[model samples]
Target: MTKQLLKPDYIFESSWEVCNKVGGIYTVLSTRAKTLQAAFPDRIFFIGPDVWRGKENPLFTEDESALRLWREHVKNEGLDVRVGRWNIPGHPISILVDFSPFYNQKNEIYTQAWLDYQVDSLHAYGDYDEASMFSYAAGKVVESFYRYYLSAQDKVIYQAHEWMTGLGALYVQKKVPEIATVFTTHATSIGRSIAGNNKPLYDYLFAYNGDQMAQELNMQSKHSIEKQTAHHVDCFTTVSEITNNECRELLDKSADVVLMNGFEDDFVPEKSDFASKRKHAREVMLRIANKLLGTQLDDDTLIIGTSGRYEFKNKGINVYLEALNRLTRDKNLKKNVLAFINVPGWVGEAREDLLERMNSDQNYTTPLKVPFITHWLHNMTHDQVLDMLKYLNMSNAADTKVKVIFVPCYLDGKDGILNESYYDLLIGMDLSVYPSYYEPWGYTPLESVAFHVPTITTDLAGFGLWVNSVTGHEGTLQDGVKVIHRTDYNYSEVADTIKDTVSDFSALSDQEITQIREHAASIAEKALWKHFIQYYYEAYDIALRNAEKRMKKQ
Candidate 1:
């Protein structure tokens, strides 16, 4: 028999930042909150860490009576704490609980780390301690939310994001067994740990010290946590089919639904004259490239570009470099092609160390040495990114008018790179490449098409698969999006493809470029964010339905 669904009186979501700013998760949460609020009226509430304070920003200031009630409640429990509220869009209230007094008294590492973080924030990013505090603060918020927000009459569904808030979910689930619990991992802590940790941590990860590290950082064994959360919740949802398979294989649990990541399609302006837009974009990009490289570029030259976080092995930056190397090696293609690499990473940090070594004349063994020996290395300060002519003098590629430019820094506004220079590059380029080995999902190729440029993505990408299916049989699809079968993260394959694609780019006439633009625009219209909201609602419905079935047996 189909059980009656349990509609939640209130849905509470916890993350590092409710509205201020962070990464892609912040984008997901803020965008979804509006739709959920509209659907459920006053039932939606967001809980988050009260990281900063300001006049314009909303803050949680309880009324005098509520403040007394909280203080007395804390005193009765022999614990000291502070709680506030911040209002974000869609939700009328976002809880901000500061447990500095309680956390400091309990954990010495957390207290010292918090102090160190405040000082580090002024000069550089204090990621380690800031991450620790976020976890600690999240736990406090969960405890406080249960105390203040919970009621016997209320049916609450609490969803926590990432491992930072996993502790809060665990704490609240243990205390309020009656309330439904759900956990979503945007990216697994262990997955990132294994990616970033230079050393091997196989057996030792679950050992006392490793366990402590996980606890201090508020992480679960990626496999174990996801499995446990799946078991505890009525249903589970993950961002991609790739993640869903990983959860099932690693955690021994299958997701109830797959919720793909999406982008705001409306942000991209539309034009009926796509041919005009393509021609203008190309001319603008050439001018920007010529300015950056301190060399003149013709609009007829074929341009290829790649941009993302500066990690070499995972994000396929090295694959791109090797490809450019091979392309330039072919004298036939060398003068006609230019590749722009925009990977923003910290200048003096460990990740940046790779850039420094690659930039130096002193060469590494094989691939790392190739960039310095072959392509140009522009290790400019973040400020110098806008100055193209000066940035170009640092290149290793043969000092032709069209050569490679590597700018290793963060891009904030469009004027710096996006619209002002980066868009011009994309507009001018014949092809864009993203051969990521471990991209959870890819956005570069989709954005490439938005600007009326053709892109090459891997079969492994979720978006790539969708594009390939829609465009594979028709030659029109080839005009816009090309799916390259990346069997592995092999550098040689990347180099060969780079050589072939650049040749193809150089061979394309104005007629072909116009045709590609028309096809790409059509594809972009269907892949917008407005359509993705439906998946979010569907996942929530499943979660709610499962919660109802479990409650009936109880």
Candidate 2:
């Protein structure tokens, strides 16, 4: 008879974004934490860098009482850490290690890594040292914890995320051979660099050598650690099938398991609450747009937005702007369109004129001077969005039916202009477009759909491809998402497609729009963690089984 697979007795997961909400990895880890916590109870622990050493981290709640014995032992070993519970649904136990002391021994760590695993860190630069030190320290924390608490009979797993945490995964693999290691790279460093640098990523994906491209793009150190970790770990995984392909080509290794990023629906409002909150969202968004543009926008105005890290070409900011330009020129448009760029940028401050208008009850009729952006940027002349607006002569004239506004500040519910979070303002948008050229697994588009806002994304995005696969038909506004076919050289065609999509969506009836919104929510429902957490289990199984096999051989 075949034996049942062994599950991990304890799991230690580490990332640069544990309690720190830096990027999509935070979303992946935070949202999925509850499910894992429910299954394993107090057996799961997350380790992250204590970057917010002195500042109050709202995401973490430290408890001096929970792990008093372990905490005191680690402190004696010269590891400064805060034992806490992550301020999320599950409140999973977390260790936020202060890795500053590891910097003093950075060279020794790198040399040992090179000697043991042949991970090349000689050409490291930028955030490499910081990330590596933190990673190494995290690995040490896991090793120490396991030695004190766990035994050889226990099934243990240590999973590390991205290149930032690769060194830690490798370190744990070397030190605590009994602990299984899993390494997941959400996006390949070399692949993203190539796409960000304006190279033909898809068309020339086959020809580019990972090492050669890494050297050319100054990404050798990151690529080396990522590649080595993938090859060396008990289980290597990535977030999506799209990124899995990139891993095979760029990292010279394929994922043992494809652990797709999932979302939790606990954050979504109830039916009645959603209706009230959505109404408030629309009112606030429209009010801000009206004040900024000096135009009286009503409920009928078609509000559209695109937001992410301001990667001009990678996030398809350029294409989005070109689409708006085309839409502005089209004579067939009927309703007034207000397109917003909510991506964060280096801003000096909120526009004082805009602030006064928002604060006052008076309805201003005249546009503010240089009113294209809601805030003044540090590099106004050279900013990509602003530069494109200038190139296209998009002056936001009173007569123009389509107007574009850039919100160049983080919408942490405290920005002086809108004073609403991204998700809050997102619910107001009639449509959200993320025509990304190099998106790995786009949370923006997925979040837009989850908010019941129909979105237009491209086939290049992992979420977009997933939508296409699920629908079994090409995406369209009627289907809740329009997945436009995008390629390395099809920038102009993509812009025109988005322009056409907006025009088409404008003509839909109220009933049709409502149906689309319902469909969008349905698509988001399939991506919930409950339905998607099985992939993570598959990864854990693979890692554990492989670790057992390796130990038997040893």
Query: Which number leads on TM-score?
Result: 2
Clashing residue pairs in candidate 2 are none
lDDT of the candidates, in the order given: 0.56, 0.91
Off by over 4 Å in 2: 1-5
Cα lDDT tens digits for candidate 1, 371-432: 32112334433323323333333344335434665545444333233344454445555678
Error of 2 at 536 (Å): 0.6
Total clashes in model 2, counting residue pairs 3 or more apart in sequence or in different chains: 0
* Candidate 2 local lDDT, 1-554, one digit each (tens): 95565689999999999999998899999999999999999999999999999999999999999889988999899999999899999999999999999988988999999998899999999999999999999999999899888999999999999999999998888788899999999999999999989899998888889999999999999999999999999999998788888998898899998887889877677888997898899899888878877888899999999999989999999999999999988777778899999999998988898898989988878888887898899999889999999999998887788999999999998877888888888888899999999988999999999989999999999999989999998888888999999988999999999998898888889999999999999999999999888888888888998888888888
Worst 10 residues of 1 by lDDT: 117-126
In TM-score terms, candidate 2 sits at 0.98
